[model samples]
Target: MKAIVVVGASLAGLRGAEALRQQGFDGTLTMIGAEPHLPYDRPPLSKEVLRGTWEPEQASLVRGDNIDKLELDLRLGRRATSLDTGRRRVELDDGSAVSYDGLLIATGATPRRLPGTDGMEGVHTLRTLDDCLAIRAGLERGPRVAVVGAGFIGAEVAATCRQRGLDVTMIEMLPVPLEPAVGADVGEALAAVHRDEGVDLRLGVGVDAIEGDGRVEAVRLSDGSRVEADLVVVGVGVAPETGWLEGSGVKVDDGVACDARCATSVPGVVAAGDVASWHNRTFDETMRVEHWSNAAEQARAATSTLLAGDGGGDPFESVPFFWSDQYDLKIQSAGRLAGADASRIVSGSLETRRFLKLYGRGGRLVGALAVNEPRRLMVMRRQIRALPDFDEAVAAASDDGSA
Candidate 1:
């Protein structure tokens, strides 16, 4: 391919562009980013940046002389309006079209917003650098904060606000936070952690509306309860950015549907990151991972698939991994945790707030979660890739003196 275009110049897009060059594809590389800035690390936006421990520059993905060496036609602040498979062209919002011999769709996702919260001064979503900055500025006011969602992002923001000694009330519709992803037992344990840190945890409740005249003044719960707030941060989740590919014939379901090799329905076009939903051969399941690690790893794999031409590359098989930092705990997980048949804490205890829990599905050891148990979590992660029997894995863990 003589020319290539990479949409969504964030972590996945930046890494994919770099991989193309590393694989000896020295073509006219054009990177289109909706954001006005260069690709920057996102995980820190919720932690250090929101807490004022790190400046905005610290989140830069490529620093010093690194980005200069990529030789990229970096088009920032420009969104890809649509894609045309017939002409191999991408239409941008700036009234320009770029033809590509190969295309990398890394459009990622946009955060879900609560209705009637738009144009409200104190309502915020943490998805971008600007979003984080606005919330951080609100934090300076020491506002009474109501976080609507118990997901990782919401939890982190609440933890950050608490660290700053702000009154934080976290609302979740589910009785246990992250129960669907990590199981009820583990979710309860996490809830205890937040409570211990002085977070006003409101479970089994949904936000009915944001009550305010012009700025967010309070959150009305579904149970007819009101959480008086000066600022509201919504962390409900995100939806994949696939609207531009509707008529592009890329086969988008929850994301851009790709095969095991990361090749999309259209030849010469592949996807990665939050926007790409590909079949993972290792797990024997189709998934779209929104973690930072998956974005980087899958980008390289998707780029390889693109370079190898149609039906030429090896399958992109990987164990999903993600980490979340809240208070004094670093929660980490590997493989698929959701929809597991069973889970057992093989190390430590929940009362101690440090443990390693193994998850099994269909008689196979499929996932592992760790609370301050990184070493054991990685070992379990590797074992998960081998697809060992759940009972045998648990026995091995006991024999190895994990508990």
Candidate 2:
């Protein structure tokens, strides 16, 4: 390939670009981004950046001599308008285009915005560095914060607000937080984490509207009640940033549909990060993961897949992994914990709020979730990969010293 291009100057994009260079691709490398900043760490934006532990600028993932020596054209603050797969070039919003022999789509995701809430002051969605900075400034005012959606982002934001001594209310349409991702039982267990921290959590309620004269002053709930709030932070979830590929013939089923190798339906165009969905040979299912770890791992896998033929690239097969921090609890999980028919605590107890829960489907170990139990979480990850019987996995996950 003479020229290579990557959309979405994302963390995954940076890693994929570096991997390509490291594999000795001395061609024209171009990185494009909608955001003005370089590829940076986003996991810290909600926690560290909000807590004043790090500045928004400090969240840049590519630091020091990492990307400086790559000699790639870094195109920041420009949106990729359309993809011309036939012409092998990406048209930009500025009416220019970048031609490439190979292209990687890593455009990640955008926070799902609330309906009729656009341009409303104090209405925030935490997706970018600027958003985090604005919210951090909002927190400094100690405003009564109403965080809509009690998923990972909402929970973290509520926790950070509570820590900052702000009046925080976390609302979820579901009966429990993260019910869609981590099942109901484990979700309720973690829900207690929020309650114990003094967060006013409203479960099983949908938002009617954001009410105010000119700024967000309250959130009308479905139950005919309203919570007084000076700010509203929406963390409902994110949708894949695939609008640019609408007519590009790249399969877009919820995301850019790829096979197990991260190769898009259109040849010479592969996708990674939140924008890519594929049948994972590991779990034997088609899924799109929106976690930081998944993005990094998939980018490396996509890079390998992109550099194949002349060089060998391994097919991507990974068990999904992600974690969250809230108050005094360190919640971690790996593998697919949602589809399991049966779940058991192999060691420790949820009553203590520090236990490892193993999930099984068809009597085979499929997933594990742990709270403040890193060692057992690691063991469970290995056992989940082993695909042992329920009894074997239970014994393996036990702290009895041997599997």
Candidate 3:
């Protein structure tokens, strides 16, 4: 029987093991997670978990019976210190090692820490369940909250702060929230939401330094402004957790380099989830995405390759899909709209915050972003996957039935 080792007990790692089992591979499954808890959904850490809407115990991704049925070897609360590709073993920080026949590197990224605040008391990040637990405890202390970096995580944290009726200030280096992911226009839409919710949305400025006598007391801005707050949540972003594999012979550029099948450069080793960057078939480019759907989709492909060498049918080029729940809106989008030639107002209106924006490149449907209209995006995803003729469909969809 083959022994499969999966590092990083994340959403992808858990799902990858399940996929291996589903593929009828009765192998020795060892899952290594740095965090002590079992695999749990992370997207909720910023929204529901932080807002006191979902308890930490309830945020678990894998339920009871799934692990026992799969017969997985769970290694919780232990960090894999390094990888030895030659010996096919993973070294743990506690001076132990686990050898494997097949390896899947799913160790997800960690929240980028603010320099000089590592051991600080109230500085927080929302990544693991322990981070959520610590931050939630601080939230109970009723400390004024300051969130750095206005990406999706920061925005969600600010929304949660408002939900909890805590005094919150969101600091961003960009002029608008979510500038890098969504364009300026879409980012402005999100910034407007925060403003309407009475959040202190400070844009175009970053933290000069976090200052306090002992614990976090205030955030000093680059613009020479000081905002007094008892707590600071740094949501700047996440960096891929690939440092442990430095000498493992696994190719690591921006992330673990892989082909369409999620195969690492090293034989007998595979990578998936946010840490894996491979040639994207749909866009015909090399890219790495740190999204929930991408992780789940890639894990299935990676596991299939490990078990039966199926390599997931074809090079995955489907438009990526991601959704975030903030307040009353469900924002959904498919495809890479970052570098589109032009975006046409498709089915919805941005003014009302309930519309869809279709992006085109060389006269083809490249991407679509919908706010509160998930069905439209679902149809748009099908069109993008099929690579349909944009002109004819736009003309035909005049009557709602075809689109």
Candidate 4:
């Protein structure tokens, strides 16, 4: 039987394997992962898992029985050190090689660790299950938590700490949470939510250093203020986990460059999830999204293209979609708005903390961000697929207009 090898036991990897099986490929499947744990849902790690609402083990997406039934050669705790595209083989860190008829590069990313704080006892990041366990344990002890980034991860961590009754403070170099992703207006709305929840939200403040001898005791800011905390969770962001493929001939820009079908430059090699960067249809540009839905959608598209056999479509086309639950609000965004030349407020009053913002470039609808209104996002999706005029839609979104 032909062997199809998937690297990185992340969301995309697991979903891709399932899609391949669903496509009726009865080949030998091997999954390689650096972490020893089974594939788990990461979006919950920073949210429910840290809040004590979910167990750490409950975060896993795939179970042992499922893998056994699939008859997948599960290689847990094995890291792919390098890839030999010419030979169609993957080199494992254990000095072993796995030959493959087809390969999928779903090796996700690692949290960018803070420098000089690696060996420190109390510094943490919430990328993997182990990291969540460590942070959850620290929260159980009611340690003061200082989060170094105000992005989604940082905000969720702060909210989780507050839910556990631990003193929490969030620090960000920007003036608001998710300023770059959603723009200043929407970001400030999120910051207000954090403040109303009793979080010490610090904006435009840089971390001078993490202060402590052997353990974290305080976080010093660039403005000379210090927040005392026994625990620190750094959510600065993540870089693509492409170190293993450094000399592997797979093109890596911001991430592994893939065509619309998620195929890499090397034949028979594909990439998906946060590790893969491809042309975004709505934005008409290349992007690498780290959201959970993106991983699943990309994997499904990649799998279909793979099974179709030879000279498939140019690329996968899916508008970006991601959601976050914090302080009773369900925030959702569809399509990419970074290149928006203009935007207008739509539906619900912005001052009331419930609204949808429409973005467009050259008068064409590009994206929409909604706060506490998920139904509107669903409508935005259909309108986005048609590439409607942003000006009319922005005016109509408030009038209960159809997508």
Q: Which candidate is the best by TM-score?
A: 1
lDDT of each residue in 170-268, candidate 1, tens digit only = 999999999999999989999999999999999999989999999888999999999999999999999999999988889998999999999999988
Pairing residues by index, what is the TM-score of model 3?
A: 0.95
Go through the candidates in order and give each one's C-alpha lDDT.
0.93, 0.87, 0.83, 0.86
Residue clash pairs of candidate 2: 40-60, 40-61
TM-score of each: 0.98, 0.97, 0.95, 0.96
Judged by whole-model lDDT over C-alpha atoms, candidate 3 comes out at 0.83
Local error of candidate 4 at 153, Å? 0.5
Q: In model 2, state the lDDT of residue 200.
A: 92
Clashing pairs in 3: 282-317, 348-355
For model 4, residues 1-403, the per-residue Cα lDDT tens digits are 3889999888999999998888788988999999998889998888888787888778878676776666789899999999998898999999999999888889888899888998899999889888988888888887888999998888888887887887889999997778778888888888988888899988999999999999999999999999999999999999999999989999999999987778888877888999999877656678999989999889878777666656674468888888887877788888877777888777786578788888888888988988888888988976887678877888678656643
Give the clash count for model 4. Answer: 3
- Per residue, candidate 2 scores C-alpha lDDT tens digits across 1-403 of 7899999898889988988998888999999999998888888888999888887677778778888898889999999999999999899989999999888999999999999898989999999988999999988888999999998899999999988888889999999888766778778987888888889999999999999877998999999989999988999989999999988888899899988889888878888998899888877889999988889889888877887843345668887888889887788898888778888887777678888888888888888889899877876777677678977778766768364
Q: Provide the lowest-lDDT 10-residue window in model 4.
A: 305-314
Query: Whole-model lDDT for model 2 versus the true structure?
Result: 0.87
The global Cα lDDT (0 to 1) of model 4 is 0.86
